[model samples]
Target: MKLTLKKGPLYLQVQEILKKRIISGVYPKHSLIPSELELKEEFDVSLITIRRAVEELSKQGYVEKKSGVGTTVLDNHAISKLSKGQRFSEYLIKEGYHLKKEFASLSTINLHEHAADLVEHFGDECYCVERLYTLEEKPYIHFKHYISKEVTLPENTDLLLDSLYEIFFQQGITFNRFKDEFGTEIPDPSIAEILEIEQQPLLQRIRYSFDINEKLIEYSVAYYNTAIHKYVVNFDV
Candidate 1:
């Protein structure tokens, strides 16, 4: 895919971008990657540069190139480890699933006590973003994110399709430590409507995230419809 990010050497950037796509299940395991000519055209680079990037991916154990069969992606079971955290979405990618997420709604509102005194870190108001994730057009997970006032969001919600962590990273707010509380709860009527499920017991997850300096930066909750799929996290040692 073509991205506007220009970082480091062109070959290295293309390699990293392709590597991320492989790990994120875009070019899934055992699938044939685009031709060298295709990638060269996509990145607007030389064929030599494209080959160099693919060579790096092969050396890194992310792909295997055959004589005439082209290049195929390798298993990405260690994606979570590479990403520095064990997340459900990463695990799904590893298990060969394409997950799509979009903003359902976004608003700035006064922080409430339910967020455990988030006002101390974000004063009175915070950005509330409602995100819905679908697998093959079937809605399954609903995420309600409360971001700190310190971080600025995009004026166009369409530009916020990436994960919150990626967005936070762009704003110089990287959260390294996260605490997750897992349980089952009857979702609110509004949340149930978003998930396309009636009010029922759904798997819930609460995340308290901290930045490099151990400062709490975000608080979010996610609801999962287990009837469709289960959440799996794999640990690498």
Candidate 2:
């Protein structure tokens, strides 16, 4: 995979990608990740860069280095959650469902359309991206993400290739907290057409993500196709 040069340090970008792999169970827990030389070949970076990335993961408790056995993954899902429980994607993935997000468009837009909804929580100007998530190759959710004006989005961002949060991280914006509101609504005709839904009530979720300073970083509204799969939330005791 090619690393973006401007996403902080090259090693950090490699570390974040490796972190995602670990979280997704690609490099399963208790398994050894690739050797520094192997990772160097995979990422087309120097051995020092791979070593630093691995060392950073090790320091974060995701892995541990052995004298000769190389680094081994210690945990698979150590990443923080948006709320108190697992997200719908995590729940579905755990249930053996394949989920994919298809990118439709990414551009700047005014929040005038959402003026009657949650527009008060965000600035009038934002970077909007329209995405549709699929489950088992079937339309499942219509997602609209409105990123804060504080982030300067690069033209090369591919929402289908990377998670939107990860893309935001590339711009040096990190979401530390999120507020979610759930409701039922009849989505707009365009969103209805994208999700292949009739003009009927559907499960809706509004999320506002914030940085450590409590400033809004992202605002998103998602409409789920409840006829295909109901939204699930887990509670861990």
Candidate 3:
């Protein structure tokens, strides 16, 4: 069947198509998926694109690849915990958690000197949005986002109800790639109180997102309460 690809990266489009097929049982559990050459012909995309899409599927645990044999689908339930390309908030909601986001603060700020190199192109100032997420009515995640001033956030947008990424997309901002750095730290008193923790450790993640033209668009830091929820990362061989 011919696939109508979307506007983003071809591999991502193909990945979504294949994932939908797997979830819909079009490619049943343990059944072999279309070979690379066959999928290439079907989608009229390059071999590299086809391979990347399949590689993503394998990494997400939807399928497994064997050198001699073709790719085989896995039980969807077995891979429900797999998180490959979703935002952390999206992952939590997909996992059946009741999530609520509250805007702790939203204002413009001078970029810190230490992180200045990360968004040097955006100059000295940027808009900052701080958010707190409650899962099951308890503090679960805290996010601090720094966005380039050049990228306009909608004045009519509601940060509490709408997704930041969705707002960016609506404003014609398309992400090309992202770089993430992970670390662990003990929260300071101020942050600890906001997170409702006394002395527990927090999983820290800093990510920089760039657009298709290679312009830095956003820098964000997230602190996760690992005692209540776990972070899972999947890597393919």
Question: Compared to the true structure, candidate 2 yields what TM-score?
Answer: 0.63
- The 10-residue segment of model 3 with minimum total lDDT is 75-84
Instruction: Give candidate 2 misplaced runs (Cα > 4 Å).
Output: 1-79, 112-123
Error of 1 at 208 (Å): 0.9
Against the reference, the lDDT scores of all candidates come to 0.77, 0.77, 0.75
Candidate 3 C-alpha lDDT tens digits along 1-237: 555545678887787678767766789999999899999998898999999988877866678899999999974432232244454566678789898875557677876653566556678788877788888889988888888888777554365346666566546665556778999977667778889899677899888887757887888888889888888653334
All models, RMSD in angstroms: 9.1, 8.2, 7.0
Candidates 1 and 3 compared: the better one by lDDT is 1
- Evaluated against the true structure, the overall lDDT of model 3 is 0.75
What's model 1's lDDT at 178? 70
Cα deviation at 130, candidate 1, in Å, is 0.7
Arranged by TM-score, best first: 2, 1, 3
lDDT of 1 at 118: 84
Angstrom error of the Cα, residue 73, model 3: value is 19
* Per-residue accuracy of model 2 over 1-237 as CA lDDT, tens digit each: 777787668897788788778876899999999888888988899989998988877765678899889999986553343544566788999999999876667777767765434456565767777788899998999988887766766576464346777556556554446788999999999889888777899999998888746787777889999899889988665
Which runs of model 1 end up more than 4 angstroms from their true locations? Answer: 1-86, 113-116
For residue 225, give model 3's deviation from the true position in Å: 0.7
Worst 10 residues of 2 by lDDT: 76-85
